[model samples]
Target: MKSTPLACAFAALFFPVIASAEAEPSGVRTNTARLMTTDAAEVIDAPVLGLQRTAIPLFAGLAVDTSLYADALLAPNLGLRWALAAGPHRVVLGARYTHFVGASTYSGIVESEAPAIQSFEPELSGPSFYGVYGLVLGPIQLQGEARYGHYTTDYLSFTGGAGFNFAGHWSVVAEAGVRVEGGSAFRAAAGIRYGGEGLGFGLGAAYVDLSDPALPGESLPVLPVLDLSWTFR
Candidate 1:
């Protein structure tokens, strides 16, 4: 199963100025900044930023954004976002729809087994809705989110993330989440990130909670992530 913070992302992008103009909630470069994959109640004001985001902040709690890469020629995508709260803490709701041509390559990948082809992969592509919350303190931000969709086996998911801003435009962040469908899966990641008006980036590692490697002497798998972006904020 998969989840997207389409609504929470909007609140994070457009609502930050509501609490205080000085409160740019993005301490890191991952769109909302509180988490790597999770999003906060802030906005991506610049033209382009982390992963693949091009956002246009329209007003106090409204913005327009596009997924530069994910909405590809083969995969059409669209969504809507609305921030429900205007205070220091953030609340938001949103929806997204995507049609992937060859989603099974990644979305349906399963554990390798003796039969070489254990099960047929399903094309999990459709509309998804989500809600997200953000809590911001002096220099720490926490976020929680939930999403539901029929994208894959009538899926549902919950994810949370935390970020600590230590210095100017520098912070540490971590996130963990679970997805439920025909089965349940857990994923987590932690790392440091930097968010600047003109440039931002992140360096971290991620691990998926799954079966261990089959071969002897083989350890668990850990994937490193390095995300970078530039913006004209």
Candidate 2:
């Protein structure tokens, strides 16, 4: 199937997950008491991926030098995120689209040799899928998530993170895990979160490295990312 169509389908799947997570926020529907978000307003993470900057496709098998903007290496590229609480349990769902525009250029040119600049632009787009299930215990919260995508050459990843809600409306979260398919590797991230009433937001970065030594000159090891979103209740 075309990448665009497949992304649409994947994006559609997140809605229900958001609904259920929003309905209850604490424990297994049957076990443990429910935990819920203290605020009712929707939250959006302006910086996604925490501190990481770039993610390369392991399956591509080729090295290409591309500018960050030309690469469209960012998320919430255009996305909608939603979350809900039930007592102390919570569910969060996010959907995002990432796009890359490719171009070519010639640095120097002589009068008779060749044109000064030449380039081509190709459309690159993919879908970002996110789901999180968590249980709140006192001042601490534990959450596990599964993420997959077709936005950057079909990849799958999983992560687990913990959050601490301190005095006032401030919280800190840290996560670590592995991403597979194309080029499998381990990634870690952490960031601060803030929210109140009907609004929430996060800022952070992430790091990713594929285990294969043969692919040494792959892409950059550090990927810097930014995420932003708005929720409607």
Candidate 3:
């Protein structure tokens, strides 16, 4: 999914600050990061059949007086990350794979619905490589990273974000970027991280907005993303 301007703001607000004071946590040198998540959604209210022609169609039928349609979506992921420490800076890199499962079906229809309620089970996965430069000052840590990758359907994307570390173990991260291949779009994301030794975990979401490739002028959008990972020694 892609991110919106608002998502970036939330990540920035929640992270990049210190709430507690304590000694820097040890074991920040090993694997350093990991994440995972599962999700489901339902869509309703339509006079016709088949995928909606525009992004706005997703919310067109959410009122109290519309017919209801239900669909299930699942996204499962896995990742690994490592750091190469330098004198005053550190480099962080990683990769991820995501699968979108389940399907969208139309139920409760009594008569012929042209095209009928169909099923869509699409999957997106690829390698994401990134670099982060880190600096330590007193009890605060600051860093920046850039990433680029292509998914299974020949979709390419590039992203970059910054983060802050508190006492070395806990951190907040935010990213703003874009995706382009045949078409172009924008994205934003944010999350929290807990890392030590060869283990780490994170939670966050992203949103995306762009034109509908299957339709003209219309837009297709995805939102409310959750990301998770794990690092091995």
- Local distance difference test values of all predictions, in order: 0.65, 0.48, 0.41
Best of the two (1, 3) by lDDT: 1
Across 145-186, the per-residue lDDT of candidate 1 in tens digits comes to: 898887656878888888888887888988888887633478
Instruction: Using lDDT as the measure, name the better of candidate 1 and candidate 2.
Output: 1
lDDT of each residue in 1-233, candidate 3, tens digit only: 88788998887776655432233333222121221111001121222221111111224322111111111223344434444545555555545444434322222221124233243333344444444555644334444545555555555555555555554666666666666763457777666655544344455765566554433455555444332223322
Record all residue pairs in model 1 with backbone atoms less than 3 Å apart, i.e. clashing: 12-41, 12-42, 12-43, 13-42, 13-43
Task: Indicate which candidate wins on lDDT.
Answer: 1
With candidate 2 superimposed using the best TM-score fit, by how many Å does residue 113's alpha carbon deviate from the native?
21
User: Comparing 2 and 3 by TM-score, which wins?
Assistant: 2
Best candidate per TM-score, number? 1
Q: Report the Cα lDDT for candidate 1.
A: 0.65
Candidate 3 lDDT trough over 10 residues, lowest sum: 35-44
At residue 212, candidate 1 shows an lDDT of: 32
| lDDT score at residue 116, model 2, on the 0-100 scale | 32
